[model samples]
Each structure stands twice: as structure tokens, then as C-alpha cells.
Target: MSKGKRTVIVTGANCGLGFESTKYLLSDKIDEWHVVLACRDESKGKQAIQQIVEIDQEYASRLTFIELDLADLDSVRNFVTNFNQEKLPPLKALICNAATQAPPNISTTKQGYDIVFGVNHLGHFLLTNLLIPHFAKNDEINSIVNVTSDTHDPKNGTPVPVPTYGPVDKLIIPPQETPKRDSRYATSKLCNILFTYELKNRLDKSDEFKNHFRVNCFNPGFMPETSLARYLDPKLFNMIVEGEGKKYRKPIANSSRYLADLVNPQLDKVSNGVYYDGNEIIPSSDESYEVSKQLELWEGSKNLIKTETDFIL
Candidate 1:
């Protein structure tokens, strides 16, 4: 391991937003970052690293791939163990970028939760809670970003329906699934904002963590060409990309750079609980601000996580 560099973890780092963000973190600034690619597939992860080599061979040394399957709670635990064993630099930031929109026809997590909620929200939820103890809470290191989508709000008027937030049980193994899967995708994204805010609230109350941590939400905005929908049926995914959907798709670079900026030191002024589009702070859906829902989601998520992983966070 190289010395004197801050380390960050980016889940689903082998492709799309995660992949591009990793590239930027490794090459866009001074040689000050070490990114651990937390991806489910080792082969794809390493392949992503080689592509980084194509960018600049030196980048390959700055990024490492670690297997993480958010769909499985046990796999999540193993990821933490593996990460700790590597003894990388102090953990600075964690970008929970791994997400999926599974069709209802497909299965949910092993725990029977909706795949979208399971991986997109619960998985990252547990990962962040587990890694809190490892964060380097210094002047320069400490930010947790949860990537979400604007589709959670009905006003945005995307193809997806607005999320229905309530008890955890209903969301787990959601009725029709999302991506219709669109409904599932939207609700899962809402959970992202809810989780981020709830986490910030919890951290704020902790005397040990309040000032040391910064958690925020980010929406890349209508990004279509990304591989975020890889879990959906290939035919459906291809049609969306090949049809009218292609016209409005935000470039991957735009979203990827926006995500990286959220954690980049250059944007340190961005405060906790703030939502962003690129560098601009913006209001999230009105539903995201409900204190009752945030609390409910937090408590229910903890229960599900504990039941599955035997963890109390």
C-alpha cells in the first residue's frame, strides 16, 4: 500500500457512475486519493481497473477492487472484514453508488426484500453503519454521500411513479417490483434520501460523531446511458436506450463528475443534509422532509438489518 493518501470506498465502482467517479478521483486532482472499488464482480472490477490503466497506467496503482454483493447481507459483512484486513489508508469518504432496478418477475434479496430496496438502500445502509467506526474524522476526511434519483418526486414527471413510503415490511419485496419496475425504482430512490437524512440526524445527535461526520444526498439527473439498470430484462433495457429515452439521457460524465464533486475537497463547503445536482444545492421531494417517515424508515431498517445480519446499528 502506498503511504500518505486518503482512502475512500465507492460501491458498485466497476461501472457507470461509480467507474467514472473512480477515474476522476484517481486522476482529476493532486495524487491524494486511494479508491477501493466495492463491486460485486471481481472480474468486472479488475477489468474496470485496467480501463483506468488505459487512462493512465499510474491510476491502476491508486485503485483497488473488493467484492461486495449488496443483495446479500452476509456478503456485505464479508466486504467489511476484507476491507479492514487490507489495512488501507484511513477511511475518508464512502460513496454508496451501487443500485439496481429489478423487474417484479425477478426475485428479491435472499432476505425477501425488494431487490431495489435491498441493494440500493438496505445494503448501503448497513455498509455505512458498519463502516462508521472506521471513518477518519479529521479536517479533510469525512463525507458520506448516497446517490439518489429525481424520479422519487411526482413533480419531476419521469416515467417512474412516485414512491409510497410507509412501513419497512411493505417495501421489502415490494408488490409489483420496480424498473414496473419503475415504481420499485422510484421508491428505492426515495429511501436513499430518507436514509441519508436520517443518518445525518443520528450523527448530529451523537457527541462522538456530530462534528466529525457529514452525510449528504446527490442526484445525477436523468442519466440514461449508465448501467444502473443492468439487473432489468435486457430487452427492456435495450429498448429504453435505443428509443426516445436516449434523447434526454444525461451523459455519464456529467453525473459521474457531479458525484465525485460531492466528496471532493474542493466542495467541502457543501454542508450536511444538503441535496445536490452537480455543485448546486437543491430541494429534494417534499415527501423527503417528513420527520415521521424518516424515523419510521430508520427504525424499520435497523430491525430488518439486525434480523438478517445480527447487527444492532
Candidate 2:
């Protein structure tokens, strides 16, 4: 492992926004960063790396792949364990970009949580907490960027309404299945913001973390081309992408530029807990700022993690 180089981990980096962001990081600032492409499928991970290499072969040495299955808590633990065992450089940023939009059917994780919530929120939540110690060890400024969506707030005029509400209890034990997939997905995105908000507050309160660590969330706006909408009916998805969603939709690379900026260490005066809308710091949903709800979500998350895994944060 190289001691002086900065390290970054981008989860779900095999394709879509994650892949594009990884490419931007590696291509735009190759000399400074060593990126870990965290994916559930090793083959897809390798393929992503190959594509990056084809674009710029010089980056091959700086990139590597690690298996991460966000749907399973055990897989999350194993990824962290393997990461620690490698003794890499102090982590500079962790981009929790892996997320899922469930199909019209009810799906559950290995631990039985709703699939959308499990992979999109709970999995990333646990992964971020597990990596906190490693982040704490870094003397340089670091960040944790949770990739969220505008759909998180129904008031934002998302094409689909987010029916489910939060407070941890309702989020963890989803009221229904199948028909509520879109709502569940929206709720999970909301969870991402909530998690980031609560985490930033906690980090700010800690003397050890206040100076070195920053946590923020990002809304990539709407990228209709990404595989995130694969579960939707193709004809409808394409029509929406090409029509109404077009105005909101940005090219994958354009959306990724915002993500890359958030990870930049030299960027000045980033307020903790702020949400970014395509490089602009903007206010998130009002519910995301509720202090009581943030605390409830934090404690509730810890409880769930303890119940599901041997490690507790």
C-alpha cells in the first residue's frame, strides 16, 4: 500500500452514476487518488475497471475492486473486515452510491428488511458506521457522501409520490409490500438524507471528529439513462426519460461531476450536513431537519445493526 496517496471507496461502482463518478475521480485526478471500486459482483467490477483502463490505461494501477453485497449484512461485515486487513492508506472519502429501486414485487434482504430500505439505506448506514474508525484515523480532511434523490421529498414534484413516512419505526417495519415499492424506494432515499444529517451532527459533536470528518448528502437530480430505473417498465421508463424526465435529467457524466466535487479535499468551507443539488448546496426536505427524528433514526439504526451483526457502532 502506498502511504502518501489518498484513498477513496465508491460503492456500487460497476455501472451507472457510480461508475461515471469513479471514472471522473480516476481520470480527472489520477495522481492523488487510489480508488476502490466496491461492487456486489466481481465480474462486473472487473469489467468496469477494464472500461476505465480502456479510457486511460495509466489509471489501472491506481484502481482495484472489492466485493460488496449491500443487501446482506454479513456481506457488509466481510467487506469491512477485508478492507481493514489490507492495511490501506487512511480513507479520504467513502461514497455510498449503491442503491436499488425495487420492482413491483415485495423483496426482502437476507436479514428480512424491505429490499429497497435494506440495500439503499440500512446497508449503507451500517457500512458507513463500520468504517468510521478508519476514517477517524486519517489526519487529513475526509468526507462521506451519501447519494440521495430528489424523490426523497414529495414536495419536490417527483414523478412518483413518496407515500411512506419516517421516524425509524415506520421505515424499518414497512407497512406493506409490492404495490408500495416506489414509496419504499422514496422512503429509503429519505433515510439516506436522515442518516447523513444525524451522522454529521454526531461527528460535529465529537472532539476527535470535528476537524477531520465531514458528512453530506447529494441529489444527482434525475439521470434517466442510468440503470436505476431498470425495474420500471422499459417503454414507460424510456418515454419518461425522453419526455417529462428530460428537463430534470442530466447526462451521467454531468451528474457525476457534482459527486466528484463533493469528494474534492481542496474544496473550501463545506458545511456539515448540507445537501447538494448538482454542485449547489441547497436545503433538503423539512422533515430531514427534524432533530427528534434524526436522533430517533440514529438510535434506531444502531439497534438494528447490533441485532443483525456482531459489531456495534
Candidate 3:
């Protein structure tokens, strides 16, 4: 690894928005940076690399793969441990782009937690916490981008409908009453923003890492063809967009491009813990920014991962 070239790890890079973001980030015009296209399947990772090479040869070498399966905590632990054990240079960017919608049933992880809660929230939460120390190693503007969704809206002040994440030990509505089809997914995405705010506060207050990293979250809007859309009932994704998201629903490519720009932009002034969809830092509902609630969510995440990993708090 070149000491001067920054490295970024983007999860779920095999297809859809993740794939598009990888393509945009590796364009020939971009700077010489290393992008670890973290994926569950190594073969697909190679395919992605090949596709990028067709775009530009130099971009091929800049992209590499690190196998990761968010549903498995052991996989998460092993990936981080291997990376840390190698004592590689400090990390530059960690993008949490992998996610899932409500499982067909109440699926459980290897650790027996709900699947969406496991992959969409806890998995990235643990990964980011484990890599915090690496960020503190340099002062060259480290970033952690959490890709959230726009569905978690504010009804008056409270996020009207929330999912049941037992691990987080907080519920806005009972699990049975909660709209499992779509609202469940929205709740997890809301958890992403809350996680970002809590983690940003940790970075800002830490004497050891205060000046090293910037934590922010964003929504890519409602993209119809992404892998996450596969979780919805047939035609449901498009139907919902037509009903409530007609104005904000965007093309997958455009969403990916906007996310790429957000990840590595030329802007000089940006706020931490803000959620950006494209160019706009859209305001989250009041509940999403509840400072105390954010802290509680952070602690819950840490405790969940602590049992399986050796990451420092």
C-alpha cells in the first residue's frame, strides 16, 4: 500500500448502487486512491474489478477485495482482525453501504438477532467501532459514511412508526402492530442516522481521535432497482414510490453518483452527523437527532458487538 494513497472500504460493492458508486469513485479523473470493494463473494469482486479495468486500466489495480458477510458476526470480526493484524496503514474512508429490508420471516443471524438489525445496523456498527483506532492514526481527513434511507419521517416530532430492535431495547411501537412490510425497514434506516450522530459525538469528544475522523450519514433516496429493493414484496417498491415518494424517487445511477460525490467531495465546509441525499444536507426528524437517544443507541450497539469482538471502546 502506498503511504500517500488513501484507502476506502465500501461494503456491498457487487451490484446496484454500490457497484455504481465503485465505478464513479474509480474514474480516471479521480485521484490515486485505493478502494477496497468489500464484498461477500470474492468471484463477483473480481468481476467488478474486471469491469472497472475496461473503464480504465489504472483503476483496476486501485480496487481490491476483502471478503465480508454482514449477517455473520464471526465474519465481521475476522475481517477486521485480519485487517488490523496486518498493521496496514491508517484507513481513510469506511463507507457502510450494505443493507437489507425486512426479511420474509423473522430471520435470525448466526448470533440469533433479527436479520435486518444484524446486517443493516449492528454489522456496520461493529465494523466502524473496530476501525476507530485506525482512523486516529492520521489527521488527513478520515470519513465514515453511513448510507441511510428517506423513509424514516417525522410525524410532528416523533418518528411515527419505528421497528422493534430488541437488542437496542427501544421500541416506538410493538412488533406485532408495526407495519412489517416497509416500516420495519424504515426504522432500521433511522437507526443508521442515530448511530451516526452518536458515533460523531464519540469522535468529537475523544482526546485520542478528535482530530482524526469525521462521521456523517446520508440517504441515497428511493432507488427502485438496487439489491435492497429485492426484499420488498413483488412490485411493492415501485408501488410505494408512486404513492408517497413520487417526488423524491431517483434513478439508481444518479443516487450512486450523488453518494460518490458526498463520499469524496471538493467542498471545504461540511457539518458532521448531517444526512445528505445528493447535494443537499437534508434535515432529519427531531427524533433522529435526539442527543440522549443517540447516545443510548451507541451504547447498545457497542454492547452487542463487545461479546463477539475485541474492539477497543
Give the number of the best model, judged by TM-score.
2
User: How does residue 134 of candidate 3 score in lDDT?
Assistant: 67
Q: Per-prediction TM-score, please?
A: 0.90, 0.92, 0.86
Alpha-carbon shift of residue 44 in model 3 (angstroms): 2.7
Weakest ten-residue segment in model 3 by summed lDDT: 156-165
- Clash pairs, model 3 backbone: none
lDDT of 2 by residue, 186-208 (tens): 88888889889888877877886
Model 1 residue runs over 4 Å out of place are 1-4, 103-105, 174-181, 231-248, 307-313
Looking at candidate 1, what is the lDDT of residue 213?
77
The full ranking of all candidates by TM-score, starting with the best, is 2, 1, 3
Clashing pairs in 2: none
Q: Write the per-residue lDDT of candidate 1 for residues 75-124, one digit (tens) a residue.
A: 98899999999888888889999888664465688777777789989999
Q: lDDT scores for all predictions?
A: 0.81, 0.81, 0.71
Better of 1 and 3 by lDDT: 1
Tens digit per residue, CA lDDT, model 3, 1-313: 2422667779998887788888877762544456777788889988988888787676755777788888888898788876666443346788899887666655666887667677888889888877777653643677788998776664422222443333375432224422444455667887898888888877787887786676788878766666776655666556666676566668877777777766563434656678886668878767787777777777777776666445555
How well does model 3 score by local distance difference test? 0.71
TM-score of 2: 0.92
